[model samples]
Target: MSIGASITVVAVGAILSFATHVHSSGFSVIAMGGVLMVVGIVALCLQIAALHRQRQMTAAEVQPPERTVVVRPPSEY
Candidate 1:
C-alpha cells in the first residue's frame, strides 16, 4: 500500500511538472511540488515501518529453544 502510494505520488509529480511546462503555474508550482514531496516521504516512512514490523514478527517466530547441554572434562568432575 505504502509502496503503491509512493509510486502514485511520483507519477502525480511527473504529470504536474509536464503540465506546468506545457501550460503555466504562476499560481502555485511550489505548493504542488511541496505537497507531492511530503506525501512521498510519508509513504516511504510507512513502507519502512511495515518492513520493520514484518521482520519483528519473523524473528519472534524463529527464536531457538533455550534448553541445551554442555559437557565438562571428566578430570574436573
Candidate 2:
C-alpha cells in the first residue's frame, strides 16, 4: 500500500482499538484493530525499503562521461 493508505489504515486501527467499545458475539474488534495496525506498519516499511532500493538503482545507473586523451606528432623542421 502507499504511504497515505498505510497511515490511514493505522489511524483506523487505532480508532478501532482505543476509541471504540463495541463487542461482537463472534469476533474481537480490538484484535482485528491490532492486526490491521501491524499490517499497516509492515506495508509502510516495505514501501519505504522499495523506494530506497529504487533510488539506489537509479543512482547506480547514472555515470559521468569518460575522459579521453590525444597526442599529436611533432612538426618537422
Candidate 3:
C-alpha cells in the first residue's frame, strides 16, 4: 500500500492494541494489532528504500555535457 495507507494501518493497530480492551475466545486483538503495526512499518521502510534507489538510478542515468577545445590561427607578428 501507499505511505499514507501504511501509516493509517499503524495508527489503527496502535489504537486497537493500547486503547481498546476486548476479550474473546477467538484471536487476540492486541496480537493482531501488533502484527498489523509490524507489517505497516515494514511496508513503509520498503517503500522508502525503493524511492531512494529510484533517485540514485535516475541520477546515474544522467549524462554530463562534453567540453570542446577551440583552436585559433596564430596572429601575424
Candidate 4:
C-alpha cells in the first residue's frame, strides 16, 4: 500500500513537472509538484520508521525476562 501510494505521488509529481514545463505560468503546478514530492518523502519516512520500530520490538522480546521469580510461602510445615 505504501509502495503504491509513493508511486502515485511520484507519478503526479512528474505530471506537474511536465505541466509546469509547458504552461510555465500557473503557480498551482509548482505548488502541486512540491506537495506531491513532500508526500512521497513523508510516506517513505513513515514506512522506514515503522519497520525500524517493529524490528526493535522483536529484538526486545528475544532476551530473557529481567525478573523471573515470584515468591510465595506455603502453608504451615
Task: Give the TM-score of each candidate.
Answer: 0.56, 0.81, 0.79, 0.57
lDDT of 2 at 10: 91
Query: For residues 1-77, what per-residue lDDT tens digits would candidate 1 score against the true structure?
Result: 57878978877876675566543557666468667867787887889899999999999989988988799767853
The digit string of per-residue lDDT tens for model 2 on 10-70 reads: 9999988999999999999999899989999999999999999999998888866688868
- Cα lDDT tens digits for candidate 4, 1-77: 48678878977887786666644565677678878878887887888888899999999999888887878888796
* lDDT (Cα) of model 3: 0.91
Across 10-42, the per-residue lDDT of candidate 3 in tens digits comes to 999999899989998888999989998998999
Which of the two, 1 or 4, has more lDDT? 4
TM-score of decoy 4: 0.57
Q: Which regions of candidate 4 fall more than 4 Å away from where they truly are?
A: 18-27, 63-77
Give the total clashing residue pairs for model 4.
Answer: 0
Steric clash pairs (candidate 3) = none
**What is candidate 2's TM-score against the reference?**
0.81
Ranking by lDDT: 2, 3, 4, 1
